[model samples]
Target: MSTEKVRAYQPETKPKRKQKQVKVKVTKKKWISTGEKYLYSVISGAMLCACAYVISFSSATDSLNRDIESMEGKIQEQQSVNNSLSYEAEQLRNPERILEIAKKHGLDIKQSQVKQAGTVSAD
Candidate 1:
Protein backbone atom coordinates (compact mmCIF):
# COMPACT_ATOMS: atom_id res chain seq x y z
CA MET A 1 0.00 0.00 0.00
CA SER A 2 1.31 3.49 -1.01
CA THR A 3 0.91 6.52 1.22
CA GLU A 4 -1.50 9.12 -0.43
CA LYS A 5 -3.05 12.48 0.65
CA VAL A 6 -6.86 12.67 0.59
CA ARG A 7 -8.43 16.03 -0.56
CA ALA A 8 -11.58 17.49 0.89
CA TYR A 9 -14.47 18.31 -1.56
CA GLN A 10 -15.33 22.03 -1.82
CA PRO A 11 -18.00 23.83 -4.05
CA GLU A 12 -16.61 26.49 -6.49
CA THR A 13 -18.43 29.83 -6.85
CA LYS A 14 -18.05 32.50 -9.62
CA PRO A 15 -18.77 36.29 -9.49
CA LYS A 16 -22.05 37.41 -11.35
CA ARG A 17 -21.64 39.87 -14.26
CA LYS A 18 -24.24 42.44 -15.43
CA GLN A 19 -26.16 41.32 -18.59
CA LYS A 20 -27.36 43.93 -21.14
CA GLN A 21 -30.98 43.81 -22.28
CA VAL A 22 -31.43 42.92 -26.03
CA LYS A 23 -34.26 44.64 -27.88
CA VAL A 24 -36.24 42.63 -30.50
CA LYS A 25 -37.72 44.65 -33.35
CA VAL A 26 -41.06 43.50 -34.70
CA THR A 27 -41.52 43.67 -38.51
CA LYS A 28 -44.80 44.84 -40.09
CA LYS A 29 -46.84 42.15 -41.92
CA LYS A 30 -47.96 42.69 -45.53
CA TRP A 31 -51.72 42.81 -46.16
CA ILE A 32 -51.51 40.66 -49.29
CA SER A 33 -49.91 37.22 -49.28
CA THR A 34 -47.53 36.02 -52.02
CA GLY A 35 -50.17 33.64 -53.42
CA GLU A 36 -52.79 36.40 -53.46
CA LYS A 37 -50.34 38.73 -55.23
CA TYR A 38 -49.73 36.12 -57.98
CA LEU A 39 -53.48 35.53 -58.38
CA TYR A 40 -54.15 39.29 -58.74
CA SER A 41 -51.36 39.62 -61.29
CA VAL A 42 -52.80 36.79 -63.45
CA ILE A 43 -56.31 38.25 -63.27
CA SER A 44 -55.07 41.72 -64.27
CA GLY A 45 -53.10 40.28 -67.22
CA ALA A 46 -56.15 38.40 -68.50
CA MET A 47 -58.27 41.51 -68.26
CA LEU A 48 -55.65 43.48 -70.16
CA CYS A 49 -55.57 40.88 -72.94
CA ALA A 50 -59.37 40.94 -73.15
CA CYS A 51 -59.39 44.70 -73.45
CA ALA A 52 -56.71 44.61 -76.15
CA TYR A 53 -58.69 42.04 -78.15
CA VAL A 54 -61.84 44.17 -77.99
CA ILE A 55 -59.98 47.29 -79.12
CA SER A 56 -58.30 45.45 -81.99
CA PHE A 57 -61.61 43.95 -83.11
CA SER A 58 -63.21 47.38 -83.10
CA SER A 59 -60.34 48.79 -85.16
CA ALA A 60 -60.59 45.99 -87.71
CA THR A 61 -64.33 46.53 -88.04
CA ASP A 62 -63.77 50.24 -88.61
CA SER A 63 -61.17 49.47 -91.26
CA LEU A 64 -63.55 47.12 -93.08
CA ASN A 65 -66.28 49.74 -92.99
CA ARG A 66 -63.94 52.29 -94.50
CA ASP A 67 -62.98 49.83 -97.24
CA ILE A 68 -66.66 49.16 -98.00
CA GLU A 69 -67.34 52.87 -98.20
CA SER A 70 -64.41 53.31 -100.58
CA MET A 71 -65.70 50.50 -102.83
CA GLU A 72 -69.17 52.06 -102.81
CA GLY A 73 -67.71 55.40 -103.86
CA LYS A 74 -65.87 53.73 -106.71
CA ILE A 75 -69.05 51.94 -107.82
CA GLN A 76 -70.93 55.23 -107.82
CA GLU A 77 -68.22 56.85 -109.95
CA GLN A 78 -68.33 53.98 -112.43
CA GLN A 79 -72.11 54.17 -112.59
CA SER A 80 -71.90 57.90 -113.40
CA VAL A 81 -69.41 57.17 -116.20
CA ASN A 82 -71.70 54.44 -117.58
CA ASN A 83 -74.67 56.83 -117.50
CA SER A 84 -72.76 59.58 -119.36
CA LEU A 85 -71.52 57.10 -122.01
CA SER A 86 -75.05 55.71 -122.51
CA TYR A 87 -76.37 59.25 -123.03
CA GLU A 88 -73.61 60.05 -125.57
CA ALA A 89 -74.32 56.78 -127.45
CA GLU A 90 -78.02 57.64 -127.57
CA GLN A 91 -77.12 61.05 -129.05
CA LEU A 92 -74.91 59.42 -131.69
CA ARG A 93 -77.65 56.89 -132.62
CA ASN A 94 -80.26 59.63 -133.35
CA PRO A 95 -81.93 59.37 -136.82
CA GLU A 96 -81.37 63.04 -137.67
CA ARG A 97 -77.71 62.79 -136.72
CA ILE A 98 -77.23 59.73 -138.95
CA LEU A 99 -78.94 61.46 -141.90
CA GLU A 100 -76.79 64.60 -141.43
CA ILE A 101 -73.61 62.53 -141.28
CA ALA A 102 -74.66 60.61 -144.46
CA LYS A 103 -75.39 63.85 -146.29
CA LYS A 104 -72.05 65.32 -145.23
CA HIS A 105 -70.38 62.23 -146.70
CA GLY A 106 -72.11 62.95 -150.09
CA LEU A 107 -74.41 59.90 -149.97
CA ASP A 108 -77.73 60.71 -151.59
CA ILE A 109 -80.07 58.43 -149.60
CA LYS A 110 -83.84 58.59 -150.28
CA GLN A 111 -86.04 59.50 -147.31
CA SER A 112 -88.23 56.43 -147.86
CA GLN A 113 -85.19 54.09 -147.86
CA VAL A 114 -83.88 55.69 -144.66
CA LYS A 115 -85.88 53.48 -142.33
CA GLN A 116 -85.41 54.22 -138.62
CA ALA A 117 -84.07 51.06 -137.00
CA GLY A 118 -85.62 50.25 -133.63
CA THR A 119 -83.93 48.38 -130.78
CA VAL A 120 -84.62 44.62 -130.47
CA SER A 121 -85.94 43.54 -127.03
CA ALA A 122 -85.10 40.10 -125.67
CA ASP A 123 -88.27 39.83 -123.59
Candidate 2:
Protein backbone atom coordinates (compact mmCIF):
# COMPACT_ATOMS: atom_id res chain seq x y z
CA MET A 1 0.00 0.00 0.00
CA SER A 2 1.31 3.50 -0.98
CA THR A 3 0.95 6.50 1.35
CA GLU A 4 -1.09 9.47 -0.27
CA LYS A 5 -2.17 12.95 0.91
CA VAL A 6 -5.88 13.99 0.35
CA ARG A 7 -6.73 17.69 -0.30
CA ALA A 8 -9.85 19.32 1.27
CA TYR A 9 -12.36 21.20 -1.04
CA GLN A 10 -12.73 24.96 -0.43
CA PRO A 11 -15.61 27.27 -1.66
CA GLU A 12 -14.59 30.65 -3.26
CA THR A 13 -15.92 33.86 -1.60
CA LYS A 14 -17.96 36.48 -3.69
CA PRO A 15 -16.70 40.04 -4.03
CA LYS A 16 -19.10 42.80 -2.78
CA ARG A 17 -20.11 45.45 -5.42
CA LYS A 18 -20.22 48.95 -3.97
CA GLN A 19 -22.30 50.75 -6.62
CA LYS A 20 -25.89 49.75 -7.48
CA GLN A 21 -25.73 47.03 -10.15
CA VAL A 22 -27.73 47.60 -13.32
CA LYS A 23 -30.39 44.95 -13.73
CA VAL A 24 -29.83 42.69 -16.73
CA LYS A 25 -33.00 42.77 -18.79
CA VAL A 26 -34.42 39.38 -19.79
CA THR A 27 -36.79 39.63 -22.75
CA LYS A 28 -39.44 36.93 -23.06
CA LYS A 29 -39.73 35.43 -26.53
CA LYS A 30 -43.25 34.60 -27.77
CA TRP A 31 -43.57 31.59 -30.13
CA ILE A 32 -46.28 31.46 -32.78
CA SER A 33 -48.45 28.33 -33.08
CA THR A 34 -48.42 26.34 -36.33
CA GLY A 35 -52.20 26.74 -36.66
CA GLU A 36 -51.93 30.50 -36.13
CA LYS A 37 -49.21 30.69 -38.81
CA TYR A 38 -51.40 28.75 -41.23
CA LEU A 39 -54.33 31.04 -40.49
CA TYR A 40 -52.22 34.11 -41.26
CA SER A 41 -51.06 32.52 -44.54
CA VAL A 42 -54.66 31.75 -45.53
CA ILE A 43 -55.84 35.25 -44.70
CA SER A 44 -52.99 36.78 -46.67
CA GLY A 45 -53.74 34.54 -49.66
CA ALA A 46 -57.43 35.55 -49.63
CA MET A 47 -56.53 39.23 -49.43
CA LEU A 48 -54.12 38.85 -52.36
CA CYS A 49 -56.81 37.19 -54.45
CA ALA A 50 -59.32 39.96 -53.65
CA CYS A 51 -56.78 42.64 -54.55
CA ALA A 52 -55.97 40.90 -57.83
CA TYR A 53 -59.65 40.72 -58.66
CA VAL A 54 -60.12 44.44 -58.05
CA ILE A 55 -57.04 45.29 -60.10
CA SER A 56 -58.21 43.17 -63.01
CA PHE A 57 -61.65 44.71 -62.87
CA SER A 58 -60.19 48.19 -62.95
CA SER A 59 -57.90 47.21 -65.83
CA ALA A 60 -60.79 45.81 -67.81
CA THR A 61 -62.86 48.94 -67.23
CA ASP A 62 -59.99 51.09 -68.45
CA SER A 63 -59.54 48.91 -71.53
CA LEU A 64 -63.24 49.11 -72.35
CA ASN A 65 -63.26 52.87 -71.95
CA ARG A 66 -60.22 53.16 -74.23
CA ASP A 67 -61.92 51.02 -76.84
CA ILE A 68 -65.06 53.14 -76.58
CA GLU A 69 -63.06 56.33 -77.05
CA SER A 70 -61.32 54.87 -80.11
CA MET A 71 -64.66 53.78 -81.58
CA GLU A 72 -66.13 57.23 -81.01
CA GLY A 73 -63.17 58.76 -82.81
CA LYS A 74 -63.69 56.41 -85.73
CA ILE A 75 -67.41 57.25 -85.79
CA GLN A 76 -66.61 60.95 -85.89
CA GLU A 77 -64.18 60.35 -88.76
CA GLN A 78 -66.80 58.38 -90.68
CA GLN A 79 -69.38 61.09 -90.09
CA SER A 80 -66.98 63.71 -91.50
CA VAL A 81 -66.40 61.53 -94.56
CA ASN A 82 -70.15 61.06 -94.98
CA ASN A 83 -70.72 64.81 -94.76
CA SER A 84 -68.02 65.43 -97.42
CA LEU A 85 -69.58 62.81 -99.71
CA SER A 86 -73.04 64.40 -99.27
CA TYR A 87 -71.62 67.81 -100.10
CA GLU A 88 -69.99 66.39 -103.23
CA ALA A 89 -73.26 64.80 -104.29
CA GLU A 90 -75.16 68.09 -103.89
CA GLN A 91 -72.47 69.91 -105.89
CA LEU A 92 -72.65 67.31 -108.65
CA ARG A 93 -76.48 67.63 -108.86
CA ASN A 94 -76.34 71.25 -110.17
CA PRO A 95 -77.77 71.40 -113.69
CA GLU A 96 -75.19 73.95 -114.88
CA ARG A 97 -72.40 71.81 -113.47
CA ILE A 98 -73.90 68.68 -115.07
CA LEU A 99 -74.14 70.44 -118.43
CA GLU A 100 -70.57 71.71 -118.15
CA ILE A 101 -69.20 68.29 -117.22
CA ALA A 102 -71.24 66.64 -119.99
CA LYS A 103 -69.91 69.12 -122.53
CA LYS A 104 -66.35 68.54 -121.32
CA HIS A 105 -66.82 64.76 -121.65
CA GLY A 106 -68.27 65.14 -125.18
CA LEU A 107 -71.70 63.82 -124.00
CA ASP A 108 -74.83 65.11 -125.75
CA ILE A 109 -77.87 66.26 -123.71
CA LYS A 110 -80.52 66.73 -126.50
CA GLN A 111 -84.19 66.57 -125.36
CA SER A 112 -84.99 63.92 -127.97
CA GLN A 113 -82.46 61.59 -126.37
CA VAL A 114 -84.60 61.52 -123.12
CA LYS A 115 -87.67 59.29 -122.65
CA GLN A 116 -90.64 59.70 -120.28
CA ALA A 117 -91.63 56.85 -118.00
CA GLY A 118 -95.26 55.77 -117.39
CA THR A 119 -96.48 56.40 -113.80
CA VAL A 120 -97.88 53.40 -111.88
CA SER A 121 -99.58 53.45 -108.48
CA ALA A 122 -99.11 50.65 -105.94
CA ASP A 123 -102.40 49.39 -104.48
Candidate 3:
Protein backbone atom coordinates (compact mmCIF):
# COMPACT_ATOMS: atom_id res chain seq x y z
CA MET A 1 0.00 0.00 0.00
CA SER A 2 2.95 2.37 -0.64
CA THR A 3 2.10 5.36 -2.80
CA GLU A 4 5.74 6.17 -3.57
CA LYS A 5 6.85 5.19 -7.09
CA VAL A 6 9.98 5.65 -9.28
CA ARG A 7 10.07 7.30 -12.75
CA ALA A 8 11.69 5.27 -15.48
CA TYR A 9 12.68 8.08 -17.87
CA GLN A 10 12.17 11.85 -18.10
CA PRO A 11 12.95 13.80 -21.25
CA GLU A 12 13.71 17.49 -21.80
CA THR A 13 12.93 18.82 -25.31
CA LYS A 14 13.86 22.23 -26.70
CA PRO A 15 13.13 23.78 -30.11
CA LYS A 16 16.10 23.70 -32.49
CA ARG A 17 17.48 27.23 -32.96
CA LYS A 18 14.26 28.72 -31.58
CA GLN A 19 12.83 29.94 -28.28
CA LYS A 20 10.86 26.91 -27.06
CA GLN A 21 11.35 24.47 -24.24
CA VAL A 22 9.27 21.50 -23.17
CA LYS A 23 9.29 18.97 -20.32
CA VAL A 24 8.16 15.44 -20.99
CA LYS A 25 6.95 13.09 -18.24
CA VAL A 26 7.26 9.33 -18.18
CA THR A 27 5.70 6.92 -15.67
CA LYS A 28 7.35 3.69 -14.51
CA LYS A 29 6.45 0.86 -12.22
CA LYS A 30 5.39 1.45 -8.62
CA TRP A 31 7.48 0.68 -5.50
CA ILE A 32 8.10 -2.93 -4.61
CA SER A 33 6.35 -4.86 -1.80
CA THR A 34 7.34 -4.53 1.88
CA GLY A 35 8.53 -8.14 1.99
CA GLU A 36 10.91 -7.57 -0.94
CA LYS A 37 12.35 -4.50 0.71
CA TYR A 38 12.91 -6.41 3.92
CA LEU A 39 14.55 -9.25 2.01
CA TYR A 40 16.98 -6.82 0.34
CA SER A 41 17.95 -5.25 3.65
CA VAL A 42 18.52 -8.64 5.28
CA ILE A 43 20.69 -9.84 2.39
CA SER A 44 22.78 -6.65 2.52
CA GLY A 45 23.38 -7.04 6.25
CA ALA A 46 24.36 -10.68 5.88
CA MET A 47 26.88 -9.81 3.16
CA LEU A 48 28.41 -7.11 5.33
CA CYS A 49 28.81 -9.51 8.25
CA ALA A 50 30.42 -12.17 6.07
CA CYS A 51 32.95 -9.70 4.66
CA ALA A 52 33.89 -8.48 8.15
CA TYR A 53 34.42 -12.04 9.42
CA VAL A 54 36.68 -12.92 6.48
CA ILE A 55 38.83 -9.84 7.04
CA SER A 56 39.21 -10.47 10.76
CA PHE A 57 39.99 -14.16 10.27
CA SER A 58 42.66 -13.49 7.64
CA SER A 59 44.41 -10.90 9.78
CA ALA A 60 44.41 -13.15 12.85
CA THR A 61 45.73 -16.09 10.85
CA ASP A 62 48.57 -13.96 9.53
CA SER A 63 49.58 -12.92 13.02
CA LEU A 64 49.51 -16.50 14.29
CA ASN A 65 51.64 -17.68 11.34
CA ARG A 66 54.24 -15.04 12.17
CA ASP A 67 54.36 -16.19 15.78
CA ILE A 68 54.86 -19.81 14.66
CA GLU A 69 57.79 -18.84 12.46
CA SER A 70 59.41 -16.89 15.28
CA MET A 71 59.04 -19.81 17.66
CA GLU A 72 60.51 -22.23 15.10
CA GLY A 73 63.57 -20.00 14.71
CA LYS A 74 64.06 -19.92 18.48
CA ILE A 75 63.83 -23.71 18.66
CA GLN A 76 66.50 -24.08 15.98
CA GLU A 77 68.79 -21.70 17.83
CA GLN A 78 68.40 -23.57 21.11
CA GLN A 79 69.00 -26.91 19.42
CA SER A 80 72.24 -25.53 17.93
CA VAL A 81 73.40 -24.39 21.37
CA ASN A 82 72.52 -27.78 22.85
CA ASN A 83 74.53 -29.57 20.16
CA SER A 84 77.58 -27.37 20.87
CA LEU A 85 77.38 -28.10 24.61
CA SER A 86 77.08 -31.84 23.91
CA TYR A 87 80.26 -31.73 21.84
CA GLU A 88 82.09 -29.97 24.68
CA ALA A 89 80.86 -32.61 27.13
CA GLU A 90 82.08 -35.39 24.86
CA GLN A 91 85.58 -33.84 24.78
CA LEU A 92 85.69 -33.49 28.55
CA ARG A 93 84.81 -37.22 29.11
CA ASN A 94 87.81 -38.59 27.19
CA PRO A 95 89.84 -40.85 29.56
CA GLU A 96 93.20 -40.20 27.76
CA ARG A 97 92.72 -36.44 28.02
CA ILE A 98 91.83 -36.76 31.72
CA LEU A 99 94.94 -38.86 32.38
CA GLU A 100 97.17 -36.44 30.47
CA ILE A 101 95.92 -33.53 32.58
CA ALA A 102 96.31 -35.60 35.76
CA LYS A 103 99.97 -36.40 34.87
CA LYS A 104 100.68 -32.71 34.51
CA HIS A 105 99.67 -32.39 38.19
CA GLY A 106 102.21 -35.14 39.20
CA LEU A 107 99.41 -37.66 40.05
CA ASP A 108 100.35 -41.32 39.47
CA ILE A 109 97.98 -44.39 39.33
CA LYS A 110 99.30 -47.50 41.04
CA GLN A 111 98.33 -50.80 39.30
CA SER A 112 97.75 -52.79 42.58
CA GLN A 113 95.23 -50.22 43.80
CA VAL A 114 93.10 -50.76 40.67
CA LYS A 115 90.32 -53.33 41.29
CA GLN A 116 88.73 -55.25 38.41
CA ALA A 117 85.21 -53.98 37.84
CA GLY A 118 82.32 -56.39 38.82
CA THR A 119 84.81 -58.87 40.44
CA VAL A 120 83.23 -60.89 43.30
CA SER A 121 84.86 -62.73 46.14
CA ALA A 122 83.17 -65.90 47.41
CA ASP A 123 84.30 -65.03 50.92
Q: Best candidate, lDDT-wise?
A: 1
TM-score of each: 0.63, 0.53, 0.63
Cα lDDT for residue 121, candidate 2:
68
Off by over 4 Å in 2: 1-32, 102-123
Clash tally, candidates in order = 0, 0, 0
Question: Which ranking of candidates, highest TM-score first?
Answer: 1, 3, 2
Candidate 1 global Cα RMSD: 11.3
lDDT of 1 at 33: 92
Query: Which candidate do you rate higher for lDDT, 1 or 2?
Result: 1
Tens-digit per-residue lDDT, 2-110, candidate 3: 3333232435456578657788888786699789999999999999999999999999999999999999999999999999999998897777777778789999976
Off by over 4 Å in 1: 1-30, 111-123
For residues 22-48, write the lDDT of model 2, one tens digit per residue: 999998765987889999999999999
Of candidates 3 and 1, the better by lDDT = 1
Per residue, candidate 1 scores C-alpha lDDT tens digits across 1-123 of: 233322233344577798998999999899999999999999999999999999999999999999999999999999999999999999998888998999899988765566666878788
For candidate 3, the 10 contiguous residues with the lowest summed lDDT are 1-10
Clash pairs (backbone) in predicted model 2: none
